[model samples]
Target chain A: MHSSTFNFERPIPAQPWRGVAVLVIVIILFAAAAWEVRCRAVGYGPTLNDTEDLWAQARRRVEPGSVVIVGDSRAWFDSDLDELERGLGSRPVQLAQPGSCAYPVLEDLANDENFHGTIICSIVPRMFFAPGGPLVENARKAVKRYHTQTLAQRASHRLAVPLEEHVAFLKERDLTTEALLKELPIPNRPGALVPPRPPPYFQSVDRERRARMTESCANPGRLQTRVKTGWSRLFTPPPPPRYIPKEAFEQRIAQAIEARFRDTTAAVEKLRRRGGKVVFVRFPVSGELKAFEDQSTPRTGIWDRLIRDSAAPGIYFEDFPELASFTCPEWSHLSAGDSVEFTRRLVPHLRTALGM
Target chain B: MLGFFKYGNFLLENFQWVLARGGITYKPPHLDVFLPIGISFYTFHSLSYTLDIYRGVMGPTRSLRDFALAVSFFPQLVAGPIVRAGDFLPQLEAPPKPQNDRFLWGLVLMTLGLFEKVVLADTMLAGSADSVFGYAGPLIALDSWLGVIAFAGQIFFDFAGYSTCAIGAALCLGFHLKDNFRFPYAAIGFSDFWRRRHISLSTFLRDYLYIPLGGNRSGAARAMINLIIVMFIGGLWHGAAWTFVVWGLLHGSYLVIERLLKAFVRPTTWTESLGVKLLIGLATYAAVCLAWVFFRASDFTVATRLLRGMFGGHAQADAILSTREILQIGIVTLGMFIVQWSLRETSLEAAVARLPRSVVTAAWAFMAGALILTQGNSNAFIYFQF
Candidate 1:
């Protein structure tokens, strides 16, 4: 069929390379110019996107004595980057992503030869203890991508980093196709038109939370926190048990955590051998969320065991009343002002551990 | 390092199972690894090039530039029509003289490829197929069949879409890539289906592997063994898993059954009656879909569960897919069947080229708009695995 169909007698062009080159140049030029115009329209410059490439670029810029903060969204929001930098001497490099677990980033740093300074890891009890759990797959994915990425990714990341730093339009938090589809008004079928509910507006925390959304997906603004607190006040009653104990499920969960801890311990000890020590910080979680965390994985069972096994010194916030009483607006994270205080309060503990 | 990382995920998982059987548990950190983007296609391309040279069907290319250019030819590099020496190398001898019309036609073909991938495959079919194959809960027969059918459509469009892009892109560069697909959904039988679908790779196997195994020149039992062996190798080439092996064996069984039946089944059943032809076509599609369950599933258990679900051997009729999703899948799949059937006698480009310019323009615009609206995560072509 192939031999029958091919037009073998067709004359070759004099210089197909010229045509290919021209097309390539035109498409690239057009895309670059169009992106600039679009970014400008959005009141942003065409900045490099902050994909793994950009994140890896940031990771590559690490130097000895530069504090690398790695953990989840609590690490992302609860620690004021500026405050941490002021309290410590150097400007901190932020590696933590919102809604991500800590161990992946810790694992990454442990593997890296260049990064010899302290990694102030914010420990979310459930995520650190349950490596294979559903909630923290993002961190796992990020780590996997980093391990498997190509050197060509570095060039692409280098190209995109400027755009990311300048243009808000290129942020990871921007509306994705899946997100837009979820919010779409389209009904699942005909006849029964699913009338879309109006936006919750001032009545809910969503709009306010959304307004505070930055590239990092960290909502740390005063207005956002106030709105969240107001919303939280309306529902002061704690959520019912987030996880029910099933024997097989719990066994797998524990095994998953223990296995990761063992792997992480070897890696961390290697880092220690390389003249760097890893310090864990239990970020403040308040009210119902803290209660849920306490019930789900208490200090003795999960966190303490992890610290002991990994041989990493951990600062549980409840041990220090100065850091502990700062109210978390969402029961998960400290607010904008509270974060600054929290950062100021927490840096000394980290510095002491780092032998600063 | 790349090889280790690429196959590491699969190897580590399998090894963990091996280790577990020995009463030892292992969870290597490297187990959490990403696959090399297009190792399967690359391996096949290399295999085709080497085997043809070994068979003396083609001479070894002493020219490194020509060899590199053919293998790494950008258009078909990642996902391919699975080219051999005769497929692409000779075209690189002289400077290309790509005509503008051919170039424009190439652009149009790229648009068509994008439409098939984005609008039909990813947007419409992927969700439903994923729902069915990935469904942990019980599923009834109807949804299960729809899911499998959607998958058949999905893989076809995804791979065909990529192949079309490769062909068109090569044409633009004044190189000819032979057509990979030829209205495969409209094939008359198993042999006909293989001839139509992924034509290059199938033909490559026929010429190199099948012929080397004595083809049909040998007696019946030996020929059957040869066919099964070729098919088994072909299946394993797609992946490293047992499911792929099963998928290959199933198709091999189908071809064997077809050859055996061809001896006894009269010509009138296939040639003269449209009802019989349609019935046969449907039965072929059903069998193909059954095989695809193994092709698509993670393991034999998942494949068996889905097959059982398709036969109404499930405890629950859970509604995972929405009615709207079902409708969208149905329309796209029907559209594909109708189009492929109509174009069985003629090529897609040839058919389109006959239409009025305005009609073509309108069609392109409609497809482009639909694609823009429904564009998903630009998933790599499905055949990139093999």
Candidate 2:
């Protein structure tokens, strides 16, 4: 059907325009290459230069049978690898970054042939109830990577897809890239360690109110005062609603987490056929972080349901309300000392949970 | 009408808030300035329809389907040639029978439009125009002029490319649409330019605004005032900002002046002299760029800074143009201008027909190849916001 018609127009006379088009194409190709090389030489690709390269190198040389902290930013900052090794006799690799949401981690584990032992994931309450929640980002990134690979392969072969398909693929790639890029990274460092710059004018009043509330929440007698202050704070709208309340937001997050857990567990069961243990741990959080979760008023039984429904056994969940009691000079993040204390308490629980 | 209501309600609410907060001055949000998706294009089409109907040149569409299809045809849904209902409804009623040759030609046209947009406009924008326009610090006088010229070329190609895509898409769906542009940069005067560029939109204004406001018939001053009113409103139709309004006023003022000048100093030659052509083009181009300052900038402060820099406020010229960017800008502008100029005497369909069959076949192949190779990273059509 494709080769039915041949244009027998004067034996296809040598067209000067074709030569011009060829010349133009060649020049464009050379120019593009030069521009790319120049951009790379000047380090333009990633915002944080050499960050990915560092990860790639770290991935290659990690010692076998070492503890692995596999999660997002909380895992990156909260888990003290040296302290864990000192206490548990194994140094852990912190295989996580700021914006590494749950699904990618699960996909990575599913694809890994050598992944064994425990995998700790941090499931923050706010993450579950955030607009443009994690599921969208996961689906977007997966589709983007798929489309990019497809286009790159087609280009290499000097082949083209149909215009409609090409447009569809490009649109998907764009939507995915946009969503992923806009996904704000959870700040990893402790506030005291980072020492955030003075609040902008828009944030000054809100910051003061939050600080006062935190200070009040620390005192038992001032709990009533803090509650009054929180209600009064709502009377005066602070820096846009920090979190908008929508059932869809929470549902999206829950679905995303459940999907990740189910997929990861199924993959792990396949590996278990060859005799490998798979233990899933929900990482510990600071007291203030736990307080945020308490405020969230999570739909009762969703977390328990997810854990119970998982295909794999050895699922350990940590709900450390005491972590919030520590004087970690941040709304959510734990101090280094608090992180060490939490890990010391968590390691034994994980060991028992994994039957190690 | 619903678009107007939505925009008006949004603006009024924002304006009221700004007024209520007496002590603190407030800038309107970005959403305030952006036109609803298809407002500018569709409103122009609506205005054209009413005018055509009133003029007894075309009847009102008999069925809502015909009128709706005429207005909301997906291909030209965002940007447009402002397809008149008179010309469009017949085609919608009895959609053209799709022939293989027509389909192939439509494909070729669509490919060409994509090439013009993605390869030419997108690359030039990413490489040079964006940076040059965005330059905050000092710029040489020559650099400013160059920037303006580049912008003129960019807007022309961008808009014309969009129109081509709309028309080509319509053709592919077995419908005929009117041409929006006709090598407008080659025009010698404001009137000539209007005649050639966005023909439907200009005609709409002529029929609805200018004529209603005592167009040309009233004495010179009143006529000028009428012209200014039309253009200013036209500009506001593009955006909800003072900049767009000012841009429109500037063009309207120029048209008035150009008309008066033509009346007093009539050229003896049928063709305008090369010097006159160059002078008019340069003058008009510069005027357009000055107006674009308002179009591009966030506020008057940024526009002022850009204008000052353009006029050699700092006199920095060391890194104005990179060699590669210059080549790209040169090739795209020269290639497009030459093709447009050559096709001035012929319809695009006729021009394609004139080519040898092999050349025609190869041109389609080449266009397809180009579209595939450089289909950029899916930037939204600029007019979509408007």
Candidate 3:
């Protein structure tokens, strides 16, 4: 009975489709990862942009003998590097963006291996109160999520390690190129032009009037101001413009500047162990703008306190009220004539401050 | 149990105001939290399984490993079609051999889900949904209607995408799961729609609550009372909020009225015609929209403000129906309805399998690419709160 038929039968094998599909998915993921790595290697990521490029270029190009003039927009547009060189016996390199403060400039100097020269950080209280400063918040959050070693921690570990432990420590943690890249002073593109050639140099009142006329015609708001020509137009007047009180506007601006300054300081300190000096400066303001600053007494008091407390062995210059007569064309910034004069005046003081 | 304590601790600490307002006795520092991701959904599934076993409808699982695997199965772990133990366990016991056709089809289904979530839902939300929902003043009738339609589409696509992905993943592992939705918007009545939408959860509620509370045994009044109780609990299940409770109660009331009307006023041939069906569908959809205001809003106050706006409490009617909003709503609504209608007969897996291999592969690649491009900022699922 057991030997009946004695026929051999084969069982169908299970298909490997699931394994194949998984393989395909793995390949796709690998391809994506490879592409992302390639992109990053070429300096293509969300954080790498024109600003970073400019900073990187400047960091590499600047030499030990270079005199660097550093501040916010005032330092960029207010002080002429050529005039400083002509006045002082050395050429000054302008390292400034429109709304940058002292901390970034200091961090740049400390981080750059090639930069071994004098740094003049312009401390503009108004610049300290500029907007958009929570730059490191997301980076911090990402670091926290990914458990990446911070620069401070890495530096501490490296400093603590003996010569024999160096290779092992280096093997344990990947060096952050971002940290190195951020040591450079990134330049921002020039901001929108402020209309009305800013009340031309105080000496030339008639020149100011001509500039105002040109501005009035060119500016949208000034152009919108209608002449009382027709009865119909007078009867059907346009709605009053939505107005923000000057005080409120200044308060918001001040808050933004303070926040940015604090954030930039934190970022600088994070990168400071790499051996960078930090500075904060206040650029000169015109007499009319000085009046506005004086009117904002509380903010001014706070600004003074912030400057005094932020002593990082760097310059905290208030070129305002002192240099107001020499350079300022408008409420805050300098005219071309004023910029040249101000640069000439700043050279000796900067050299003395930087110990060059 | 640890997850329960963690959630309990969180609630005790964060929502003392809610308890204080309700005059509920509770104390913080007496709670703990061991938050497992998607603890809410998993707990509900566990409860459903335990209750079913208790009722003698399903036997208790002998193996803890099987139970744990079923509960924590990654595809449906975060969000789900709420797979039942009875339906899911048998497949695990005797795993089917994976077929090439099935694997390809699963890929197709996954892609379709991604398309619904990223392309349709995310784009629609970025356009009109955010603006309309966030509008402060009373909505014009047209704007309110558009917002409701947009929301309906959003919720369907979002949940359906999750469900399809879950099913596809399960299929890949040689298991079959139930469909969670079946063209719910196309349903003629509230009852029909409920049957189609979140079917597993709805069935669980019916079996656990309605039947235990004597259901329709006593009278219409008792039945109404039972419905209200069930719905209130359902709402509470969604979140620790009065708004959700109220939303549930409102839906319960609607269902009761519908049932009562059905018993008392039998429809004639004409009344049961296409026009009548259309009217009923629109009325049911409108009611669902009203409830969603409460569901989506942070609290009852916000929901009331939104309702008032919808009824033209503040703004002129013309101000509500902006051309851009209408166009955005129209596009989303069309896309949602098309997908829903197409996936009605066959399961998403089956439908994809029917397509030519080349088309299926291309469709999947395109969907995967789109998902990557337009990924939502949110990593958490909407239903994770429940």
Best by lDDT: 1
Give the per-residue lDDT digits (tens) of candidate 3, residues B233-310. Answer: 777777666778898888788888889889987989987897787688768877888888887777666577667767
Per-residue accuracy of model 3 over A30-126 as CA lDDT, tens digit each: 6456645664453233211112223333434457556565555556656666666776567665555443544455554545555555555665543
Point out where model 3 deviates above 4 Å: A1-356, B1-34, B126-148, B315-326, B339-366, B375-379
Runs of candidate 2 exceeding 4 Å displacement: A1-356, B2-6, B13-37, B50-57, B315-321
Better of 1 and 2 by TM-score: 1
What TM-score goes with each of the models? 0.74, 0.54, 0.59
Candidate 1 CAPRI level: incorrect
- Candidate 1, residue B161: the lDDT equals 91
If chain B of candidate 2 is superposed on the true chain B, what is its TM-score? 0.86
Ranking of models by DockQ? 1, 3, 2
Model 3 RMSD vs true structure: 14.5
Q: In what order do the candidates fall by TM-score, top score first? A: 1, 3, 2
lDDT of 2 at A191: 18
| Per-residue alpha-carbon lDDT of candidate 2 for residues B64-153, written as tens digits (9 for 90 to 100) | 777777778888878777776766765655547755545545555677777667656665653356666665444556555556556667
How well is each residue in A22-124 modelled by candidate 2, as lDDT tens digits? 5546755664456446534532231111123224333443443445554444555456665667766666655544334554544455456665544555544
RMSD of 1: 7.6
Poorly placed runs, candidate 1 (over 4 Å): A1-50, A111-115, A131-136, A159-174, A185-246, A254-275, A284-345, A352-355, B1-72, B87-90, B114-147, B211-225, B267-276, B314-331, B356-359, B362-380
| Pairs that clash in candidate 1 | A12-B97, A13-B96, A13-B97, A47-A163, A47-A164, A48-A160, A48-A163, A48-A164
